[model samples]
Target chain A: MSTTVDRPLRADARRNREKVLDAARGAFAETGLHAQIEDIARRAGVGVGTVYRHFPTKDALVAALAEAHFAHLADIVEAGARREGDAWEVFAATILDSAAPTAGDAALCEIIAGHPQAIEAAALGQERLKAATGALMGAAQRAGQMRDDATVQDVQAIMCGFGQVAAAQRAGAQMDWQRYLTIALDGLRAR
Target chain B: MSTTVDRPLRADARRNREKVLDAARGAFAETGLHAQIEDIARRAGVGVGTVYRHFPTKDALVAALAEAHFAHLADIVEAGARREGDAWEVFAATILDSAAPTAGDAALCEIIAGHPQAIEAAALGQERLKAATGALMGAAQRAGQMRDDATVQDVQAIMCGFGQVAAAQRAGAQMDWQRYLTIALDGLRAR
Candidate 1:
């Protein structure tokens, strides 16, 4: 029988892992998936070999980074769910905040899109995200804070539109997602 | 001074003009400015010489077609402004309907983008479009059906987003622009 190694990473190893993720996040946000892994390692102040030792492959590194970002977003959604006040307000607040890409999520998307395996992993993450969003939407509807006629699909569309606008803005193009959002929402309000 | 042509075109000339415009609209839509004028004349069941007789240059043809289309859109916008009841509802209806390419506007865009001189003429048409859209939006705000905070810029963004979704639909891709529009508008409503 082969024995499995169960040893923990050393302190230096852990620090290197954190640094690599941070650097990768920044690089992806600035230039997209084409950003080089060696550059990320250099920015992280780690050797290329050290980054490989820690992450195995660029895709693996990106998938791990993406997981962490989604976990952070899930935390925000959970926090909003637990907030006191109308459930609709909580859901709306969370949705609005999440509309813009954080440096991490954008990088994760750029990184993962190149790797088929990472794309599958991201799909799983997206499913988990949908469930979290659905919960918030349901609570709002139940509390009469939001119009019952509105569906989870409606919320997802807003998120997508907002993300597209934010992406354009990141590219130094000005596009407003807010005012149209206001006018559309007025149409959806319960009479 | 040359007398403005006092006589209307004879029956055969009028028939040729209509045939040419229809063919030009379709050819422009399919192939933009690269669509050969000879091909357009063939499609119109006329000679290349006849096409030249009716339209002195590609810009002349494109400008005439664009002028007619923009004038029609302007009429719609004006009608919406004069609507007595809910301005918001009418405004939304008009935008949603017009956002999709009619068989005509797509041809105009294709021709304008295909030819440099036509592009300049198209710019003039766009200026007219913006003026009409601004007037309609102003009316909606004055009636308090739309949020006072909404700007013409925001409306333009919504139109752009809708256009993207419409283009996707045209290519047989499904995207829920309608749902997105609803959620976005709900978010914008004065709550």
Candidate 2:
């Protein structure tokens, strides 16, 4: 076995790994899952071999990136849940934050919608986000911020709709997802 | 020139034409714009040559089908506008009825969204639908049923979103578009 495989990653190696992930994230955010690994390597100032060694495959890299983003979203939603304010504001704000970034990300939105059967790890990440969303929704309903009948499924449908709207906006339809989401959120509010 | 081109369509010829259009409508509604002309002819129990005679190309057939649907939607919106009821109810009902069918028809939704630059006739049909929708929305706003801040653009965005939700629902995700639209419409209502 190569000594490089046996030894722990040194500081420079770790730095290179982080750089590659960062480059991949930026590339994917800009160009979606179709972002080329060679381009990502060039952006990271690393060799294509280095990227392949770390990721092994494109799906692996994509799944890793998707998991991280989903986890980040869950973190954001959970943080919002703990914030001191109207429950609905926390809810709406979190959604707006996600929608704005995701509007340009076709790959991430596909993962969110669970279309074409996402990878197991990415699907797990989505499940985590869904659970976190459910908690926030339940908290809002209990606080009388959201209507009693509102379900996480309804929120999922709305989020998927808003994601497409964001895409439509990107595709030259001039419309505000934030305003439309607010309207839906208002509908979710308890009387 | 072929004699058939100059002669008035006998009853049988007219019936065949209607059959081809009907078959095209059903196939497109079921399988979208990708619905094959041969499949449409087979479904109509007519020969493929018959389909070709009536519709010179798939785009022409698809465009005609989209125009007819748009015209039908425009009529529905206009009829709703004339109906005796609360303006908001009229508006909401019209949206729900349109969404239910459109949710299943992806190609029509794409045309409605003006994606890939829809045919001129399909675009014209959409314009008529928008005018009718505008009339209903204006009536609702004037009657103090909907918010003054709400614009026809908002309605279009919502319709686009709902049409997507309907599509999503068809693709194995169980969702109640009516309930969600109710929430969205509630958000549209004047305070």
Q: Which candidate gets the maximum lDDT versus the true structure?
A: 2
Tens-place lDDT digits, model 2, residues A110-177: 45543434435767666777787887888788898898988888887787667667656666687887
Q: Which segments of candidate 1 are over 4 A away from where they belong?
A: A1-15, A46-60, A100-120, A123-125, A175-188, B1-86, B102-129, B159-175, B186-191
lDDT (10s digit) by residue, model 2, range B69-122: 777777777787777788888889887776666667766755554343453666
CAPRI quality level assigned to candidate 1 from its DockQ score: incorrect
- Number of the top-ranking candidate, with TM-score as the measure: 2
Those runs of model 2 whose alpha carbons end farther than 4 Å from true positions after fitting are: A1-65, A110-116, A119-121, B1-19, B44-57, B109-116
Give each model a TM-score: 0.61, 0.79
DockQ metric for all predictions:
0.20, 0.46
- The DockQ for candidate 2, computed on C-alphas, is 0.46
